[model samples]
Target: MIERSVRGEAVWIRLDRPAKMNALHLDGWRELYGELDRASEEARVAVITGTEEAFCAGDDIETLDAMESADDVSELAVELRRVLFGIEELPVPVIAAVNGLAYGGGCEIVAASDLAVAVEDATFALPETRIGAYPPYAVERMAELVGKKRSMELALTGEPIDAETALEWGLVNRVVPRSELTDAVSAFVDDVVRSPKESIRLTKRHALAGKPSTGDEDRIAGALARASLSEECRDATQTFLEGGGSEEE
Candidate 1:
């Protein structure tokens, strides 16, 4: 589930499903969209984070297992893509406070955010290829942020990177000690929020203006649909969920 709270001009959006490492199901995505929409109305900046030991693990395995058709897969992918895009287009800057592991869609969230600050122990990866699926948004945004070569390594290798590597690769803007993560983010947001709101918004818009359009949503949706319906993907996901394969391993 998603929890929302106000902290002066910044709103905090926390993913609270600690038991599952804050992995979101479809309903959770819907709730997040609603929260973001509402928060955008009143907040000058938004900070997204997660509870317990994870910023977010990714999509829920149980939800993925329950998908029965290509159309189902496509619909889920499209909705998630839209939500991430919404975050990107927000008038105010969105900061990801990556406290721990961020994988799959969680990594996509970091890619979409305007800025990110991660704890030293936090890790990031797009491991969809491990289960025969591909992260559609990451295909474009990761490459946009980290360039083609590094993006290819992350997408194709299905391996996790430590916070230092993530910072060196430009996945995150800064990495701080776990104990100082919150203060670092607070200071960063405070500095950003002190700037004129219009200038900040315009700066974000101008930075986004240089991004190349991929126009790959349909192709990505098709790929996700195909992969989600594949026997290998299904079996691999089942094994992982049943404790045969660890996502972090």
Candidate 2:
């Protein structure tokens, strides 16, 4: 289940499946794309969280481990890669609010986000190899977040990293007391919303560029409003001139 709520300029997106330890299946990835689109279109930044103690314990291994062949795993990996890449490409910044354990696919999602604020009590890992599987999605994406060597160690060993180590490895942007995660993310959201929208979008474009650091690099999308979006310009500019807060048009 994808749950949505708002706090200031942040739209909190929750993955609600605590019964399965918030483990996600292919369908969950689709739902997550929808939730992300909604939040990206409406808010300056997004906070993705899980409903229970674990942010997500990774993919639904029960679904994958019983698969017939390697092709089955590859197909699933491709689709999930599309989802994580989609999140990475969003014009607005996404902040993973990892309140508890974030393993496997959950950690991949956090890897895709621009910022991650993990609670000190939260733990993370990639245990796909332990189940006779590999983490292609995490390899392609998470390597940039925590560097190649660390990612390999975690993936191969299946040992979870505490929040402190994750913070040091740059897996999470900040580590905070579990009780203050929400408030801390909200503060960042408020700061982003008060800034120029285009600037925010453009900055993110440059940031994502760092991920696929190679030739032709001119691919930029959604960071700037097209000339055709005049109505958007009107409203945004009007909001700006009106002091962007309580004042009316």
Residue 59 Cα positional deviation in candidate 2, in Å, after optimal superposition: 0.8
For candidate 1, which ten residues in a row score worst on lDDT?
A: 240-249
- Which prediction has the highest lDDT against the true structure? 1
Which sections of candidate 1 miss by over 4 Å? 215-217, 244-249
What is the per-residue lDDT of model 1 for residues 1-249, given as tens digits with 9 covering 90 to 100? 898888888889999998888888888878887778777788888899999779988888778888998888877777787678778778888889999999988888888888899998998998988777877778877887888999999899978999999899888999998888778888888999889989987987887797776535687678888888899988888877788444421
- Each model's TM-score? 0.94, 0.79
Look at candidate 1 and tell me the lDDT of residue 28: 82
Q: What is the lDDT of every predicted structure here?
A: 0.84, 0.71
Off by over 4 Å in 2: 69-75, 213-249
lDDT value, residue 73 of candidate 1: 80
For residues 1-249, write the lDDT of model 2, one tens digit per residue. Answer: 778898777789888988777877768877888788888888888889998677877677555433444455444555566567777678888989998888877888888888889998998888655444455556666767788899898888878889999999999888999899988888777777888889988898877665654211121111111211234443544443355321110
